[model samples]
Target: MSGMQDRSWWGREARATVALAYPLVLTNLAQALIPATDVVLLGWAGPKVLAAGSLGVNLYNACMIFGVGVMIAASPMMARALGQRAHNVRDVRRTVRQSLWAAVALVIPIWLLLWHSEGILLLFRQEPELAKQASHLIRPMMFGMLPLFVYQVLKSFVSALERPGWAFAAGAFAVFSNAILNYALIFGKFGLPALGLYGAGLGSTISNSVMAVGLAIVVTRHRHFRRYYLFGNFWRPDWARFAQVWRLGLPIAVTLGMEVTIFNAAVFLMGMIGEPELAAHAVAIQIASLCFMVPLGIGQATTVRVGLAYGRHDRVGVGRAGWAAFGVTMVFMVCSASLMLLAPRFLVGLFLDVHTPANAHVIDLAVAFLTVAALFQLVDGAQAVGAGMLRGIHDTAVPMLFAALGYWVIGFGTAILFAFHLGWGGIGVWVGLAAGLAAAAVLMMTRWMRREKLGLI
Candidate 1:
């Protein structure tokens, strides 16, 4: 009877985790699509536009990752409050309100910097033409940043309510709307002017703006979310919670930086190797990124689950939530890893023509990178979910340190040794990525396992 009970409990936890996870997964994938569509539009424009647009996009993404972390803080905060009392209206409302305030504070400085994006690129000694072209793309695209930030806060709000389907609905709408608008604006279709790179930028901005507004409308009008009166006051001060948001959020941003910047760094390293290697890295990274969304979504859902448990002071519930997410993440990672390993060439061909003699060298290198990417899928998922588990318990500082040590010190250091010193080239750089993720996975999961001993519970 005890064995049967254990099995039943695990089954229930697994189902609950997946129930919260699927919609979030689709939402994340939809978020990815907005950018993916931009890439497609740029590719159609030509390689020069594609390259310039990519540079602008990368620069914008760096800031997005950092600033959005502050907004995501509200998720755990609200989740915990809700767990304490299912209808903790005042507290949940304050968190959502402060998250908006935090979003406004975050956007200003980033806007100032992105305004001179071309100059920043030049400061880094990028090609003058590329820098100028990139600025054209960024200037209009930068306007969308605030909308994206606002959208994130709203997303967190809806997600915390466990009504993630609303955000997904908004995101799905953005996907189609962005594609259509970009097509018309970028290519001069349907009586729209062909503004090229500027068109892509403008289209995405409009799409994000509409997405935020649409979601805002739903939250305000929908009977379920309307009771919270999320936007109850246009102006109010919740200084304490506002500071708490930043205090808990900056580490999360830096932790994200450790992972994102390393990959950005690898692009430069590949550039040092050769054009073919650089090209291959881009294709391989995109494939890996798409696969990563599943585990990443699971991690997001895990944060809320674990936070709910943590708020109730239910240690067993916390453990069950965390492990359930980890298990689900592992299962998905394994399937993705197998696919990458078993059919690397076929996957590479999805981006490049396999039969083209001109593409052979780049395709070969991409296949090699995919193989390495497959090797690291499990550790990557482990680290992603582990960070979520820790974040649920309001534990960010130590994990930030772990990320710095592992991703930079251990991970980047090994990449340097293998790629340059040992003459591994592009392949060696991938090895470093694996090493860094592995180190983070081991350290983070270990910390989580010892949560009780460390008084985190």
Candidate 2:
């Protein structure tokens, strides 16, 4: 009986982690696919469109990161609740409903900001043509803001409950719809008007809306979730719970903003060098983002597992979950880095038309940038995993400080010095970034280890 209990518990952790992480990885991949497809399809529209789309997407992405971070607070809280089995069905239903309403509140302002993106871009003094194109892309994509926000809220709830297959199915559906829309709208296939870069934005918006509604339907219909949907009771706002959400989510939101701003600052600095350099930086960032999904997926699992284990006072389980995620992330990073190093040109060529005259310099620069990118993956993976582990312990504030100091003070400062004072150019800036990430990795890992020794994790 003891052996059987041990086996069952082991199976639960393994199955739960894998089930959550697999769908998350797939969803991350699908999210990446949208931009990957955009880069390919927009190539036909010329360099200006590509540049505009890149800038607009980067801007939007930076803003969205804050929302994503805020939403993550929900998962840990929900996971803890599930672990303790403290909440009744009605309570769970109320929490989920309130969360959705909170999401709606958060999304509205962001959508408004997106609508006024043209004014924001004007402040940058970007090339007029590029700004116009960016405005076009931004406008259509704004429609997706609410849907994406709503989906994320639901996703957090599902993942926390260890039901990630539903989220994966939703992501799959969105990807399929996005692909079809991109082909039809970008190229004017099957009698659709060719909207070029605008089409890509529209396609994303439509796909997000579909995914949000579809997932909502599925969740509402499911036996586990149906009990949580108390019509009149669920609709009312609970100020106390909302305040708790805000308290937990706000710091995460701020941390995300700072991190994304640091990256955006880097991108802006890259643009000052020239279009080719900017494009190269974009390529490297994209490749890194793809590699990042592994840590991200594992991180989600870690957060859930840790939260659950902590609530149960299962210290060993928490430690194991954190280590399992870290190990998996490291292995994935190594493989991803290998692929990037081995076929730098091939990877760049997949996005940019290498043979084209306008793209020749961009392709060459991308290949060069990716070489520097390859070395940073190990440190990046380490830092991400360490942060994930920390999050599992509900220790967010210090990690946020670490990120700000490391990325801004060390990373950006080093880049400015190396890029300008030392005449090291783009490679110098990348090296600075590597240094920052490596420092962050070391510091975070040390902190996590100390916390573990204290029995905090």
- For candidate 1, write residues 273-363 as lDDT tens digits: 7657766776788788778888888988999999999999999899999998999999999999999999999987766668878678878
Best by TM-score: 1
Location of the lowest summed lDDT over 10 successive residues in candidate 2: 86-95
Stretches of candidate 2 off by over 4 Å are 1-16, 86-88, 230-232, 452-457
> What's the TM-score of each model vs. the native?
0.95, 0.92
User: For model 1, what is the error of residue 295's alpha carbon versus the real structure, in angstroms, after optimal superposition?
Assistant: 1.0
Which parts of model 1 have CA positions greater than 4 angstroms off? 46-48, 122-125, 353-358
**Cα error of candidate 2 at position 423, Å:** 2.8
lDDT of model 2, residue 273: 63
For candidate 1, the per-residue lDDT at 402 reads: 94
